[model samples]
Target: MGHDLNLNAMNYFEAVARLGGVSKAAEELGVSASAVSQQIRQLEQQFGVRLFRREKRRLILTLDGERLFQTTTQAFRMMRDVRSAIVRQRENRHFIMRVSPSFGVRWLAPRLKGFLDANPGWDLRVDGAPDFSDFETEIVDLDLRYGAGDWSGLHQEAVVHDFVLPMCSPSYLAELKEQSGDPIGQLLKARLIDSVKTHFRWDFWLARHGAMGGRMVYPLRFDRSNMAIQVAADGAGVVLESATLAINELERGDLVPLSRAFAVIKVPTYWLVCPSRHTNRRIVRLFSEWMRKEGSAHDDKTADMLRSLGCTIQEEESTILNRDIDDARQ
Candidate 1:
């Protein structure tokens, strides 16, 4: 059989091997089960080898099948990468940025309209998730990372320093005040929602406020800070989170600080990171400067808000200025 004629059969066989059953492969390929089976059989005949073995209704790939699958997978991935590169190169006006989901949704999304309005000639594409893009393979131009700004082979600039405080819904706070008369004491006794990624725990916050040895009651843990913040805003429980990430809720009067005490975790600040090669690019420089200005403005606003609430924003020594950029460049 000609190689061109066997291409369709190979595709059907690959799908069957990957999906582990003929019916599943057929459903995925939008074809009938019998048709998929027939194509697999034709491929086997053409190659003069059995590609899959059926046992207990499960289709397992044979050695030949595994080899072919590996080759096809790499080929498809390369094709996709090539196509993406071509598309990105053809569109010279778009700026690709990557950021964590919480920052993207709570902070950047709100201010994006202003940025776009100010720069109508430029188009923005944001990829928001927990996963950072690999610049070697992906066409990511800028990354907003929550870290110590010490990543090797990248240009890093500190954008925002995070300060965390105990926050809860306003109604919940009112209810606590009305019930126990001591809102902080009532909060310590109530359910505590926490993020697993928090730099400091409730015990740390309690200790800083001289309320040590008071254990949090019925703690609920979430993987993301935004999830805990959302749950706290819905009056589920008190949560310890960055004031920066909860700025929207605070402004909307959905969440209120439970106390006048806060802890600044100096290690994890929002950093603007980009490939060394792209650091000198005009667009990267423009975005970095804009981010710095916006971040500084937000810090000032948050500080003012804290003062209004009679909360003393704790000052933590930051290594942002101490870091030797000379060593970083090397």
Candidate 2:
């Protein structure tokens, strides 16, 4: 009995240990449970050790099994990355970027055409999902994510620090005015739409104005701000959303602020994130620059618009702290 290792058996052993069962590993591998079990048996026989113990009909890895699984997982990850990188180059997958769903639909989609048109022959693939990309196994170039800019070990820069305000269609505003004289009473009586995914909520903004425990009815709820904003613009309800995402609707007079005050959201600023190595890539660098410019322009236009609308802004105490900035005061 030579101490030679079987790669096929190693694969099956890795799957069983990682998934905690032979059936699951078999299903994922598109093989039968018997075959997976056979492989595990052969691996154990070759190594002359019990790799897993059956605890209450569930597989629990032994110390040796755990150590091997760790090595196998890392090896598999590296192989996948190498394969993906080669495939991307062969298929001309130039650059892949990911952004959050609402930001893609409400903010970036309209302005993406210019970047595509400017960069000829660059195959840029964009994915809009809530899940953050794990740069270890995927060949992602850059990420435009909405967060507190606190992702560790990655280089990130703030693209925009935006505020949230109550917005509704002009027609809805007229309806509210006709129904009541007190703005707070009118808002309480009207349908309040909630964007469930945002860090800022109707309650937080309402709390700022000392309007707590009102009979607020959220007849509608959405996971994306784009959907909520659109619903509000259709005169269905009033949505408290980021001013930057609702800029187009505001400019077109499709949506108007329900209040004279905007709550500055201190966290969840849009950030451009990437591994330090990827940050120096030409496409990543150029796109990051474009995003900053667009963000700055949006801020300028938003400031001008808010000034014209005769609105003031509010900021709550810091939910996330930065060492360099002054702490937010009430």
Candidate 3:
């Protein structure tokens, strides 16, 4: 039997396998589940093997399906990259950079103007999301990430080390002052906005001041650090966030350190992470250099912003501590 496999069938089958079901794959591809199922069946007929089996009304990939799926995964990824390359040429304005959401909002977004203002001809498209693994799949040219400089199969360049601390809106601090003498003491009585269980925590910071085990009421428990920071600015609670995330707000007087009680501590830092394959790319090199200067100097800038607000930071300690607020949202 001469069976010719259709490219569309292979595409649909690949999406279904990657997404675990036809329904999900259809949603991702903006199609109908029945359409995906028909395509998968067509692929199976072409290959002369059963691709899937119904297990309690759920599609389960057969052994043949598994093998085909593996091959198709790489095939699709390569094709996507080729497509991206073509798109890149047509959009020849500047670099397309990918960044984690909080990092982009708190750090890169503000600094972007300076880069663009200096290099008027270099166009940049910044893609922000929580998932770092998508860098390769999404064809991101560069990444500004918050981690321990340990991204597998990628070139990682240091930007700045980070630390976590308490932050609240300046208005919230003012109101607390008018309401009570000690706002930190008052906050201790209220909820401390917390991220889900992760590397950075309030216990780490609180332990420095010998404070612990306070009642926590999550008015909002957001998985995204950026959202938590925004809610904190809305006077939701005193959020224990990264200096990196709060830098802009602190500088803008939108969010401020809860009180002198807050102490900055050492935590994970941001890195200019990207595929090592493109290390020599001029734009990537330029962006990485700019990131190092901007990220490392975050402390100095935050200190200046803090000092201008009459918040004296101790020089003996690393003032304006930077840290990772890349919380895993569940």
Candidate 4:
């Protein structure tokens, strides 16, 4: 065999060996099947041995291929560890958290200052888009999902349980008070902002309030819950949204509760989810604990605000690991 072999050819061969097929490896590497085959052929010619035996469509790894795969696997893992360690050393610690868009924007985004203040020099990548299947493949450290925390292969921690409540701009409320004797009646007349995908509207709250008589009107319907809340803030309408989402706006006097027409909603709880194992990443552990503790702190703050207002508020809480999943369909 001639000794002018290329590392690039070996990489293609390694991909084929690990994936068990030239075509699949080519697809993953964004190259043509023929190109991958050519690279494998070049590698085998250089090594003076066939790395794989073709049986029908299957590419069975030969003895040489197996030996190469074991070595390459270790090499790849070591390379990954070195990259991660370098990043950690530069930033103190690395944290990548995946969370839903609305949750991240409405809740997490506003409160991240504290986390940043506490964990100075920590590198964090917050993915607001909610596809988590690739989290494992991408080596993501943590994911936050809004559900019962039934992620099959993740270490799950429940952060907070949430409820939907009627919210509107204070200006809208003032207008109602000026025009109508009863704010609830005026709210029924005001434009109703709809979160189209979540199927949340004033009718849902009206049903809970025993005033399901009015035909709701909508000036705008938003596909995103955040957009609907934005419209409500602009005095476009009254929006029914998760209290946790609207908390910052409410505290800042941007949004106000219209009435006590909020029903207990099953959706929109904070769950700290990640791959079922790997408790060894100190960054992951620290972020998870911080999420749970901070979520609890927010709940307590809400309860305290309610108490100061001369209203007794009942606070419900649950951990992700212990949340009741039996009533999912109920």
Q: How does each model score on lDDT?
A: 0.76, 0.80, 0.71, 0.71
Candidate 1 local lDDT, 1-330, one digit each (tens): 454557678778767766788998899889999999899988888778888888886888899988988876676657769999898778758789999888888888898887777667677899887887798999899998875666888888888777677889988877777767565677656678878665456665565565644474446898788899999999988888888899778888899887554433333478898888888777787788788889989988987776777777656644542343222323
* TM-score of candidate 1 on Cα atoms, chains taken together: 0.63
From the highest lDDT down, the ranking of the candidates is 2, 1, 4, 3
What are the models' TM-scores?
Answer: 0.63, 0.65, 0.57, 0.59
Better of 1 and 4 by lDDT: 1
Q: Looking at model 4, which ten-residue stretch has the lowest summed lDDT?
A: 321-330
**Candidate 1 Cα misplacement greater than 4 A, ranges:** 1-91, 178-184, 207-218, 261-268, 318-330
| Residues forming the 10-long window of minimal summed lDDT in candidate 3 | 321-330
Tens-digit lDDT string for candidate 4 (1-330):
336758678778878887889888999889999999998888888788888998998999899888987887777668869999897788676687788788888888888998889878887889887566466468677778776555676777777656556778989978877777675677667777777654245555565465555565567777777888878888877887766777667777788877543333434367887765655788777777788898888766765543443433433443321333222212
Clashing pairs in 1: none
Better of 1 and 3 by lDDT: 1
lDDT string, candidate 3, 193-297, tens digits: 776533456654554455554543455577778888888888877888766677767767778777765545544466788778778888887777777677768
RMSD of 2: 15.9
Where model 3 places Cα greater than 4 Å from the true spot, the runs are 1-94, 120-123, 134-138, 161-163, 174-184, 197-199, 214-217, 266-268, 307-330
Model 2 steric clash pairs: none
Report residue 35 deviation for candidate 3 (angstroms). 59
Superposed by TM-score, candidate 2 places the C-alpha of residue 286 at a distance from the truth, in angstroms, of 1.2
lDDT of 1: 0.76
Query: Which pairs in model 4 have colliding backbones?
Result: 154-276, 158-320
What ranking emerges by TM-score with the best candidate at the front? 2, 1, 4, 3
